[model samples]
Target chain A: MAIQQFEHGKMTLEQFEILLDTLGTNFDSWPKMKQAEARNLAQTLDGKRLFRGAQKLEMLMMALQSTPQSTSQSVPESSSESPLVNSAVTPCDTQKEAFLEKLADIPRRYQQNSAHLTVCNRMTLFVTQALAVNSDGSRLFSPQRLASQAAAFAAVLAVGILVGITPEETPTGSGEIDLSETWFVASSDFELGE
Target chain B: MPNRDKADDTILVARVCAGDSDAFRLLVIRHGARFRMLAMRFTFDQALAEDVVQEAFISLWLKAGKFDGAKASFTTWFHRIVINKCLDYKRKRQFSALPDGYDRADPAVGPEVKLAADGASNRLKTVLSALSERQKTAVILSYYSGLSNQEAAEVMQMNIKAYESLLVRSRAKMRKMLMAEKDDLFAAFA
Candidate 1:
């Protein structure tokens, strides 16, 4: 059978992937200049998934504005505190303030943690009990208890075994053992008369 | 947009590294949708994708200062974080549903087929259902999610050559499947 050639053209898979990326960018309305720049930038990154150099620089700019600046420099530092220490403390304070501001926006985090803690506690308790039972010799489940149940079963089995081993009586009673005759034969009076 | 252009990722990383919570939110808003789509392709569940996006953003915040532009693009760095989170989610799900295969097919195909035929988007989903998991992920990430082969490879954590193979196989499969459907349409016309 002849192999059918699809019209993928002379484009390599990488080129096709890049074209697809360009289409996506166009769909997202990235500016013409930015798209051109991004295409050139993508060429450098080649095998990498990240945008490097100026493109990264551009993304960094947008990220910075969205984040708030700290203004804790106005606070007076103690005599023991170094200027470096004060500067470091300012950023931390700013972050804490920002976190508190956004805390109300994330009610689900608290709910999820609480629910997780509850489940974890219950599982921990169950595991502890299971471990305790398996560890302590006296408290551990006894094989004897299981064997006692088996012994009751064995007693019933022994009765069944004895019944099977015993000879059945014939209608003529030929196979029957006569206990009376055996007892009389054992007696001394019959031997003395003889 | 001008304000965005002036601010820069390094500046944002500086702020975030210094522990600026709002900086992190900005990062989230900027890349959340792309990350979400990337995640959705991998997991095929909207809710799980959202969680993956959130986790990715959180890790970005925690590790902002560690981002070195000299090594890679900020976008690449950010996506690496997202992909890892998705992989972790897959791993946890694997352990939780051990022995039960995780194929995403609907159990009630009869009802689903009717539902699928009613809408164009649903029809796309039905077509996507016929693909292998890796092929589906590769195609969706490349076409729908707007990732380049390199980017998709990074997300999938596969080598360039391997990723290319996956893309080739996936595209070939899609072409075959779509062509079959087209032939059926032509037959009906004839």
Candidate 2:
């Protein structure tokens, strides 16, 4: 039936290649019609070459699976290791142990991050409480709350701008010198000298 | 069986999200070795593979909340993470020296003889490394790691048809490369 389809122009070489890619080179597992069509196609020269290439690919993958894994060596397996890990039977139990040892610190580090976040959260909570129109948390976004939040934001932005524009100065033996003021003073002194 | 694994993974992930380290440990123990093997296929270095797996699991720990089991299986999600780490590692360390005490080919022995003696797996690895990263990934995901085409496509973030097409092109390219070394490969095998 598939051979007839192929012969009748139903299955093109491109479509056959798609099937070959999707279904692999194995004809036996294909649907009966496709199996017949594919087997018939496989007999042709182009089909033969395509099938051979797929077979070689399968063989290469097989060789990879059978290859002696570089990491597989005779190392004692630990008791806590999973059977899935050991099923590969590679001597990676030590590596797994190391991973788990590293994993042990995750919660602590996570808690530390949580602690850091908590401080920020507490600040946010304080500001939120101050902005709250009601203690029961109703009307949290009331007009007054918005005004307060806006004012807080504007104040913070103003402080940031101020800090950003302030010129940095080095403390000398006498004390910190204002470079801008010193320049202005020297210029005035030069004008007076003139 | 897969359903049970999925359920187990879902629960474990939920626990990890709840800050349960023991659940996270179990998850690592169950999947770490296989993940390492997958990484090794990409890096070809045990230590590098370990680092890739470490980075992947660390991301898993830090971003457990991002995973949605309803949309995709945990394994598929984690596979994407590992593959991304492998790709990132490859990009970061594009140039590396040969391992210490590496054996150079003998002047007396022909290249063909040397390749044959190294075995088909090694020769195939050489050919695979010569392919583009996507092609290499297509081969590794489909064949070495035993993922279904659909699953591999999802892991690669490509459509199923595109993944299959990539596999076809990859295999064809590998066959061409092997044929060029036919004297070493086909002759020895034949």
Candidate 3:
């Protein structure tokens, strides 16, 4: 496929770079259709350079992963292997047996966890219900409270508008002098006002 | 074989969600080793890795009911759970005296790691430590764990494109840093 794509020239240099960056030079995990294109690109001069960079980064990563194990407890032999650790996948029959021994307790453990999950659900429901209900059995989100909140909000909005519109002092017909509100004033202006 | 295992995982997960502990055991035996491997890659500490696996299993037992087969395979969802635990452990132990989670994961390391330690790795870690936590996590989950960009994004709760960009930048930064310390890395790995 890579050869086919290479002969056909299916991808551009920029697209090739994106593929290199996103999926790396390995076409193993790319889409079936795109793998050929990627592999084809990887063999190119630019692609090889990018691949070398990725390979170096990957090698450094391998070094990071090769940390010394500090634990004393014996671990099951490494049995699961992927394409990356091609040479390392070995059978761990003893580990399988030890693991099987622990398998029996899972039911009891799951039961305990299920019970715990149930308790948590019930507690959550109770708390939510308690929060939304008044002791008098009226809902906290009752229409009456909602209407009162709306009215309070409207009153606040009206006061804000009045303050905004009447930022300067005004004397009314009743001879009542209104003081300027400086809540929204700049600090310097407020200081000058003081 | 992988497809069959994945199918079995789907079945086991369904049963576990329905409160079948037996199915959960099968799930554990089937996936536990792989989970441990992932945890080891992230944390390096054997006990800590074990804890991560345990917490992930417990979460699966409790939350499997929420799994949506139509959306993702059990493998991907479970990946999110385990990686979350790994990252959680990493965050809680963020300021440890150890250079990285790798150090705290083990007290006495093998010899090869020690030889490299005095050279490029320490420098590499210094550059890595300078990265944002999410950036470092993205690299680990993608590069070391071998997750796809999409799967890595799912695990980290980030957009796929965002995760890819993060990996790109992290790798670019590493490339730059390593370029500067070429001789040291050569000595370390040589």
**Against the true structure, whose lDDT is highest?**
2
Per-residue accuracy of model 1 over B1-190 as CA lDDT, tens digit each: 4323222444454455555545545554444545655665566555576667766665555445456644555676777777667667877874232111123333433443323222323334455667776666676666555557887777667877787767666554444444444333222112
TM-score, prediction 3: 0.52
> Candidate 3, residues B1-190: lDDT per residue as tens digits?
5554565566566666667676776677556666766776566454577777777787777777677655777778887788778879988875344432433322344556665643445555566766777787787677556567787888777888788788877776765565555444465554
In terms of lDDT, the poorest run of 10 residues in model 1 chain B is: B95-104
lDDT of 1 at B60: 56
The TM-scores, chain A only, for the candidates as listed are 0.20, 0.39, 0.31
Q: Residue pairs in steric clash, candidate 2?
A: none
Q: Clashes in each model (backbone N, CA, C under 3 Å)?
A: 8, 0, 1
Please compute the TM-score of chain B alone for each predicted structure, in the order given.
Answer: 0.63, 0.84, 0.74
lDDT of 1 by residue, A64-156 (tens): 222222011232222233223334443334333333233312322322222323454444434323323332344232567668889999999
By descending lDDT, how would the candidates be arranged? 2, 3, 1
For each candidate, the DockQ is 0.02, 0.11, 0.11
After superposition, the stretches of candidate 1 with alpha carbons farther than 4 Å from their true spots are A1-194, B1-7, B94-137, B153-162, B177-190
Most accurate candidate by TM-score:
2
lDDT of 3 at B13: 66
DockQ, 0 to 1 scale, candidate 1: 0.02
Look at candidate 2 and tell me the lDDT of residue B88.
94
